[model samples]
Structures are given as structure tokens and as C-alpha cells.
Target chain A: MANVLVNAPKTAKRGSIVEIKALILHPMETGFRPGPNGRIIPRNIIERFTATWNGTEIFDMEMSPAIAANPFVSFFAVASESGTVGLRWTGDEGFVVEERVAIAVE
Target chain B: MIARHFGIGLAIVFIASYALAQGMADKGGTDKRRSGTQDMGGVLQKMQDDDTANPGMLFVQLGGELWGKASGASGKSCADCHGSVASMKGVAARYPAIPKGADAPVDLEGRIDLCRTANQRAGSLTSESRELLALTAYVAHQSRGFPITPPDDPRLAPFRARGEKLWQARQGQLNLSCAICHDDNAGKKLAGVTIPEAHPTGYPIYRLEWQTLGSLKRRLRNCLAGIRAEPYAYDAPEYVMLDLFLMDRARGMMLESPGVRP
Candidate 1:
């Protein structure tokens, strides 16, 4: 599907508490299915996920197929001096997608 | 100005054609291993042989012991009500079966309810509860060696077809069909993890991540939520039908219930 989402306040002042939410779009398929010829389909899954803020990585995950499809992750990140909050998804395909949002410092 | 514009247009055309040619070449040159769906049998086999002793197996053992214990007003055990489970071997492979007068099939949880009401004289166990999972695992384990052969009777045809439809149905915000990822792109890595084919051979598994034993239906519910799809209630007919479809697809694959998995 799609990668996880990270949503938070677009702007925050230094020393403020902020809420961070991340959701990944995944099928988390168990890879036990077979093909038309009935050969066992091999397993392909996302092993890890990570998030960073202004070059400092904050949240990271080691995931399995059991984590389900499109995993939604939510947590908290303290608001320091605002910079760029970057989100990246690395999968078996290698670096599938990345997004960055500029956080305003008040 | 006109001459300059014409030159710019010719340059754009050249660049576009070159890019198109490069894309075609890349497609032919890309490594097949990078395409995903690589063989992982060795890894899976290793995991399977790693150990039979797991916390989930403990739950199954508890269920086996519970089968013989007397409970409820009848003071009768499952063994007393239904006879020896040995006689019922391979019965688990038949479940998620269509009940008489019902439009769809019933899962092991629902079947347990039938037993509770008809034989045990007890209330139905809540869906997704520990007791239900333990009993489901216990019963399914009885059919460990049996092939997953769903009935081919005429009455079952509609539900079986319906179940297959559900498997391929697209739902949720992502607009993804289960087959798209599970069937079409299976074995491709997403976020650094390999995507396993969607199979049901080893379920009611002990997930090291969850640190608890869980059923196939639980995993199904989680998948629905992950896709932003509204989940059917546990033991719901839709889920049963879906389970039947998945189980049939995993036919010939050995059962490894109470399996330990990451």
C-alpha cells in the first residue's frame, strides 16, 4: 500500500510539548500464498521503519508481517528549535518514499 | 524569438526520447533479485525447525487439559459431551463451515459457541478472548496432518466463491485489493522487510512482537485496520468465509499451529 504517516503540529515553539503520529500503509502479507502453478510464494516484508527531525532520528521500528498492513504509529516528540522534520520509508525495495515538512519555530 | 522557441521545443523532444530509451534499457538491465519475490524457503524452514517449545504451545496444552475438565451446570467435559477428540481428528479442517439455515459459514469461534450452547450448557465465549483462542488452537491442532480440504458440495459453492471474491476485493483509504500486494507483489520488501505471501498454514501463532498467542482472525482484523478498512467482528460470517478461502489456498501445506513468529 502506502507508507506510514507522520502528522504533528506544523508549528511549535521551543520547549513545548507536541504530539507526533505516524501511520504506514502496508499489507504486511504473511507470504504463505502460492502462484497459479501452486509453487509457494516467498515472503517479502518490511523489516524496519524510522523517522527523524532536523537530522536527529527520533522514532524507529523493527517490524514483522504480523504488524499488519498499513501500520499506524503514534507517539510524542518535544518541540525544540524548529527545523525540518523528515520521514522516510525503507523497505525491501530500498528507500521507497520520503517526505519533509518545515517546522516553524516561534 | 520564434527561432529560439523552435530550438527549445526540439531540445525538449530530444530529451524526452532519450529518457524514454533510457527507461527501456533500465527495465531490461534491472536485477531480478531487486524485483522482490525471491526464494525464502531456507529461512522459513530454519524458523520452522528452530523450536517446537513456545508460549503459544503452552496455551494449546491448557486447552487440551480444559477439554477434559468439567465445567458449567451440566458438570460435563468436552470429552464427555463430544467423545474423544481422536474421533474428531481432521474435523478442524472442515470448519468455518456453513451452518444449517445460515447464509454464510461459521468459524471455529462460532462452532465453539454451538457446542457451548448445545452441549456444555454454557454461555458463548467472547470472540478474540483467550479462552476462545486456546480452544480454537486445541481443536485445529487435532487436524495437524490433514490436508485443508473444504467441502466440494453444491451448497458450499456460493460461499466458497464469495470468500474468494472477498479475498480479491479492494477496500479502505489505500484502495488496495488484498491480491494486489499479497498475490501480485508477494515476496517484495516493503520498508526493508520481505512481504510474505498471504498464507494461513501457521496461524493462531505466537507473535514475538505481540508477546502473546493470537489467532488467524485476530491477524485478519489487524490487517483490515491497517488498510483503514472497517473490520468485521470476530467470528463474523464474513471473516469465516474469508478464513475458508485462505485455508483452502493453503491446502497441502503442513499445519504449524501455536507457531512462534516475529
Candidate 2:
């Protein structure tokens, strides 16, 4: 279970700018910090985040170690039609989480 | 050196004021206590206020899932007996309660562990583990906005007394007690950070300093370490007693469990 959270309006006026909020729970560990045994912690971060509207990419972002734990991104997309907003986060260790939210355009 | 002397003199002044404040509290003229959230910047405050953005909600989500999903040898989940999480409202406000057939108080985590071993036939979750923290946050979230109302059982009186004594007594290499900071200097800045009047209205808090949810015991350990004092084990009775005293002190104050704090 990825424990992802997404907040977006269920209904929006067509051609209107709709705001979307997405968050995922991840440690986003940077390789620099040492553990209690004094060994460096391995770098493991969400590498990319993408949002799609009705299977077409609307926004994309590249993340690095600088991003804090539990990466959160908020963006806007135009409500052109009734469709699903799909969010995908890919990270180290073959980590992939995909979630979808439906919006009915009025 | 002169600096060391001045430090001791300042400590004495703090102690004197603390005693005076205690006297005032006894006489019912003490200053109103405020939550740590009041000391936070607006950005952080908003982060806590919004459930969608609040990181602690992630755990609460897990907790909600665990509540219904059956586990353990008995094949029972929390919902099997407790019904719905909504029924837990106002429950967190009255803990660290004295359980029946128990000599002392057990905080929420302790009670949950007891249930695991006794009723669910499951292993107890480790201290500060995600599952325990998640479950606690989920349960306590139900009590959000309800006033803290420590149970007034007669058996709790002694433990509460001991807790108050510990709260007032000076300890550590710096000879500082919880009172010197949270009592006498509350709302005053230390190293440019405001000292909140230590209240346990929130447990399983999502502290920005920790970058994760932590229990009241964890926060107490941090304070103990800051004062250069030896902290007890995570399951120490002293911690529960201290929790009881703090909650009693903050009686009538609203709970903000899964609270976000900077």
C-alpha cells in the first residue's frame, strides 16, 4: 500500500483551471547521512512524478535528493472534459505508485 | 568563571519565579496555558490545519485500514469490537486512564498493546513503530477538538502527585526541570524559539523537527536529553504519570491529536 493522498475537485466548469494536490509517503533518504553504525545511508528518492489527463501527460517533474521526505506536489490542469486525472510516482528500488481521481466537467 | 556564576544566578531566579507561579496556581490565579502550535509560523500552522497536506494523515489512513482488516490468531480487528472509529470520539481526552485491575495508569499505546496480547492474540507493536503510531493517530484523531478531561479516579491521585513532583523538581547537569522552561519561561524565546507551556493535548504529533509523527514519550525523551538528564525506558511508568499530570494540567483545553508542530 503506497498510502498516497490526492485532493482535487470532483466537478469543475469546462475550460476552467482546476487545482490538484498529491502526496506520497516516502523516506526520500539521501545517501549522505550516516546510520547509528556510522555507515552512510543509501540514496533512495522518488525520481519522477507525472500527471496525466485522460491518458495524456499534463505535467511532469524530476525530483532529487534535495526533496524532503513524503514528496508533495500541487499543480493546476484545465478541465476540458469528464475524465480521470492519473498520478504516477517512480522512485528507486523499483518503486512505482499510480493513483487516479475522476473529475466531472460541467 | 563569572559566566558560570551568572548562569547559576539566573537559574536561581528562574526557580524563584517558578515557585511563585506554583503558589499562584494553587491560589487559582495562574496564567492561561497555550499549545505549541501558537508558537509556530503561519506556513507550518496551515500545513497542520489542512488534512490533505498534513503528513500525519498518511498514518491515520493506514490506521483506518488496519481498523477494519482482520489480523492475529484470533482473526479479529479493532472494528470487530469498537464498531467505528467515530465511536472513539472523546476517548483520547480521558487517557492515560487507570485500567481495571491495574495498579497504575496506561497510556493509549500501552492499552493497545494490552489488547493485542489479551484479546487479539497478537504480538505487541514496538515502541514508536509505524503501526503503533498509525493506530494511535487514527484513534486519537476521533477526539480532535474535544476538551482534555483526565479521569478523576481516586487511584490516579498518587501517580498524579508523583508526576507533579517530578515536573517541579530540578534535575540534569544544568539543574533544569520541566517547570523552569515550560512554566516560568513559557511563551518566552529560547534560542529564538518560543517555549510552549508543556501540554500533552496532542499525542502522535507530526513535528517538523522530527519530520515524522512521534509520541509524547518521544518528545519527553528529547526534553530529557536536552536537559542532559537520563531518560527512562520507553515503557517507564514515570512517563505515563508525567503524561497524566500534563493532561490534567491542560484540562478543558481542546485536543489536536496527530497535531503538526514546528
Candidate 3:
């Protein structure tokens, strides 16, 4: 199961930019590191992250192994109207997590 | 004459280092104590100050969920009895307490497990397990900003003394003691990292080193390993004693649980 945290303003003025932060718990293990048995721990990281507003994609990031564990991403998006903001993450081993939050624009 | 001069130089160096160590130890009561957070750079400190940016909050969130979820045959959750996590305030400050009928001290983690087995009728979570850490962090998080208040019962004196002995005793291949670094060299850089006073103020902390949340025992074990010393088992009483002493030493220091550290 994926443990994720997302923070965004619940309300925003129309056409104003609102900041959003998202965090997801993952080891982000680089392939070069050794395990207890002295064998290399395989690379396992969240490869992609995307955020959409009102069914339109607004923010996207391609992650790498250099990113720290429990990847946290922060960005801003223009609040066009009252709608739902959808966040998605995808990675190695077919890992995927989807979450959404609603915002009211006045 | 050359041999005699070399011997004199060696003696002076040895005495100087020993004096430095002793000077710090002698200044113990008078020396000011600073928290580990003070050693951190501004960026990391800022990271700790801000809740939304701190990664440790993720585990705190997990703990909040576990606090309410029901499990085991009793079908009772922590919320059924404790009401809310808010009720746990100031509780973590007085941990490593000697529970009734028990001769030894049990830290907050042990108390949680005791509650599970006796009250919740559930099995104890394994030491260092994610669920256990989550619950521990959640409980300690409530006590954040409160001062650490080690219990004043007289029976705890011996254990606290034992902990102090361990703190002062040198061990391992390097023959170094906790005081050698934390007390003597505190605030000084070791291998480019500044050493703090080894206070137990912030525990179950989120360390960038481990890239995960960990308890006080984990940090103790790490230091022991760093000194090339054999570490005590996870459930050893010595850890409790050491914890007891650390909390006492850090008395009046604000508890910063679920804290961020380098």
C-alpha cells in the first residue's frame, strides 16, 4: 500500500496561482548500494509524477534515483475554476498511486 | 638526549589530550548543554521547523491512522480508551518509567506494547516495526514542545547511576566513551559533522541518514557500531538505563519528537 500526503489550498481566488505539495513514501533505492548480504540492492524508484486540474494536465515531473526517499514535490498551479485536482505517481515494478483533492474557486 | 626529548614530547601530548577530556568532564555541571538541532545547518533546521516540508509527518500521519483503527480479538482501538492523541500530551516526557510490579524501566515503546498485550489483548508489535514506530511517533508527537520530566521516584536512582557509568566508561577498539564525544567534544566537528550533547530530547526522529524514522535505541546502536563496540540486544535493560539518564540529563529541554536530523 502506498502512503501519500498532499497539501493544497481548499479555497482560492479565480485565476490566482495556488501552491501544492505532495509527498509519497518510497525507499528510492539506488541500484549501486549493497544490502546486508553484500549483494547490490536493485533500483526501485518512482519514475514519474503528474498533476492535473479539471482533467487538464498542469504539472509533471520525471523522477530519478538521485531523489531522496519519501519523495516530496511542491509546485504551483493557476486556479482556473472550482474543480478537482488529480495527482498520480508511477514507477518501477508497475508501482502506481492515484490521489485527488477538491478546491473551491471564488 | 634525543631519546629523552622524544619521550618528553610523547608524554606532553598524551597528558594534553587526557586533560582536554577531563576538562570537559569536570566542567559537566557548569557546562551549558545544547540540543542536537542546534548543530544542524539553517536549511535542515528550517526543514524541521516547517511541518508540511518535514518528511517525518508522513509517519505521524500513519500513527494517527493506527490510533483509530480497530484490530485483534478485543475489537478496541486506542481511541476507544485515550479519546484522542491530544490526551497523550506530556506523557512521553516521563518515560522509561518503572511500571508497577516491574523491576526495570520500560520506555514509551515498551509501554505501548504493554498496553497492546494487556489492555488491547493484541500481540506486541516487533521492535523497530513500521507500525510500532508510527504509533510511537504519533504518541510522542503529541508531547512535542513539552519539557522532558524524568520521574522523581527514588527507586530509579540505581538505574540512572548505571546509565551514567556506561556513559563515562570507554569501550570498543577505539576505547572511546559517550562522554568523550558528546560531553567533551560536543559542538566540535568530528569528520566534518558536529557532535551534540547526546540529549534524548528528540526521538523516534526522522534522520536523513537512515532515510526513515527511528527510535532512541536505533541511534544508540549506531553510535556503538561507530565505535566498533558490540551493541546490546534490542530489549536489553541497559538501553532503558541509558535512556533514563539521557532524559534526566536533558531535563527541562523541550521535547521535539518526530524531529528532523542529519
Candidate 4:
């Protein structure tokens, strides 16, 4: 299973910015390293990452070999209300993962 | 030149362990603890301090996920029995414990296996397996700030002595011992890399060299290979004893499990 971890605050202040961090576990095999039998490992990496708040797109980006294994990304989102923020990651071999977190604002 | 240096280092370790073993028998690893990271440059140390950059955290995160999922015939997860990893605080500091009435001092991995097999009825994870490292790293991350306290038990007394002996014995084609680089020549440069004091403060760590999280046993095997010696089996008793002695030697030092090391 494509394991992903997301970190966000349980509560936030109205109209303030909150930092969100997310990471996905993967080898991101570069297809450069030679396998034990001298065969080249196939290239596999997350091709795209997207984040949304309340079903509205907040952030999106494309990735490639330059991206390190187990990619981690952090971004700031203005706190407007309480709801769930979700993220989606797409990668080679049809790997897809989603993670969601909830936040509350006073 | 390398062979000669190793011989000198071994001699120093022999004298150091002999003098310190008696005192360490009671004090644990705390007296003058230092981690290998301490000897590293700022960039590496900072990378370890920052969670996002510390690749080891990825494994810990996986472990946290595994803790809650039900598995095996028992249909239970680690969280089911050890609820709230918050309760796991400082638990790693006192481990490789000889479970009451048991003769062997199983490390964190062994303990995890026992729980999986006996309580969860889950399949055992082989040594150095990613899952095992993940779980061990997660459990160890809880004790991050706690000091190591290798148990001083009657059953462990003989094992500790044995560990000390093996640590001092010359081995491999090079006839070098651990003490050579870690003790006698600590703080010196070896082939452009700094020689650390060989303490076990941060373990189950992310090594830049290995590019993955590994146990101290893996490092020990590397050391054996460095000396051109035949390595013991993965589950060898010698490894266990050496682990015990290293923990004791590292007593009192704060743990940095799932640590990042160059």
C-alpha cells in the first residue's frame, strides 16, 4: 500500500495561515542503479501531487527524477473555517494514494 | 598503514574496556556519552535535527500506521494491546530486556517478534526487513530523549563479560578489533571520514552510506567485514552480547533512535 502521512493542526485561528506538511513513502527508483544481477532498475517516481481544501484545489505540482525518494512537501494555507483538507499522489506503476486531515478554527 | 592502525586501536580498547567495565557494571552508559553525529559536520547534524529532512522519519511514520491496523489470525494491532503510543514513552530506554524468567536479552526486534507470534499470531518479520526496522524505529522514536539503561541483571552478568571479551578479541584476516578505530583512534580521520567513539546512542538509524535505516547489528557486521573477518549469523549470540555491552557502554546517553547518521 502506498503509505502517506499528513500533519496539520487540530485547531486554527480565523484568517491565519496554517502550515501543512505531507510525505509519501516510495523508492522513487531512478532507473539508474544496477540491480544485483546487473540489470538496470526501472524508473519509478511520483509524477504529480495535488492538495485540496473542502474539495477546492489548493496546490498542485509535477515531479520527476529530480524528486528525492519519499518526497516531503510543506505549504501554508489560510485558515478560513473548519473542514477537511485532502491530498492525492500519482506515480509510476499506477500507484495512487490519498490522505485527509481535519482542522477547526475559532 | 590500515592494518597497523587497527592493531593499535584494538590494544587501546582492551585497556579501556578492562578499566571501565567494572565501573560501567553499575553506571550504565551515561557518564560521558557522545553520539557519532556529534563528530559530524553541521550540515549532516542539521539534516538529522529537521524532521522533514530526516529520511528516517518516513520509516517511523510507516510504523505509526502499522501500529493501528489489525492483522494476522488474531485480528489485532500493536495499538490494541499497547494503546496510545504516548504510553510507550521512555520504554525504549530500558530495553533488550530479559523478559521475566527468560535467559536471553532480546533487543527491540526480538520483543516485537515475540508479541507478533504469541499475541497477534502474525508472521515473523525476518531480520533487517523493512517492516521490522520500521516498527523498531517507531518504538525507539518514543524514547528519543531518554537515557539508555541496559539492565543490570544476574542472568546478564555472564553475557556482559562474554561481550567484553569478544569486543576485545582480535579477529579476521586483518587481526583488528573494534577498539582500534573507535577507541584508540577516535576523533582521528580514517580515509577522509571521522572516526567516532562507537557509542550506541542513536540507533536503528538512517545512514547516508547505507541510504536506509539499519540496526547496530548491521553496523557490527560491516565492522567485521572491514577487518576481513567472518561475520557471525544474523541471529548469533555474539551479536546479542555485543549489543548488550555497547548499550552499557552507552549508558546515560540520550537516545536518538531512528537517528540520522553519515
What is the DockQ for all candidates, taken in turn?
0.02, 0.61, 0.45, 0.23
* Descending-TM-score candidate ranking: 2, 3, 4, 1
lDDT of 1 by residue, B69-178 (tens): 87676788898967777766776776667766676677766877777776788777887677777777788777764656666656766777788898899998877777
Query: Number of backbone collisions per candidate, in order?
Result: 26, 0, 0, 8
Better of 1 and 2 by lDDT: 2
lDDT per residue, candidate 1, A33-76, as tens digits?
68689987666666776778899998887877666544556567
Q: Regarding DockQ, does 2 or 4 come out ahead? A: 2
Candidate 2 lDDT over B78-189, as tens digits, reads 9998899998999899999977788879999888888877889998899899889999999999998787899879999999999999999899998999999999989998
Candidate 3 lDDT at A95 equals 93
Model 2 clash pairs? Answer: none
Better of 1 and 3 by TM-score: 3
lDDT of 2 at B258: 85
Worst 10 residues of 1 chain A by lDDT: A21-30
TM-score of each: 0.57, 0.89, 0.86, 0.77
Top candidate, metric TM-score = 2
Off by over 4 Å in 4: A5-22, A34-40, A49-67, A73-88, A98-106, B1-32
Real A-B contacts recovered, model 3: 0.48
lDDT of model 2 at position B98: 79
- Predictions in order: lDDT: 0.68, 0.89, 0.90, 0.84
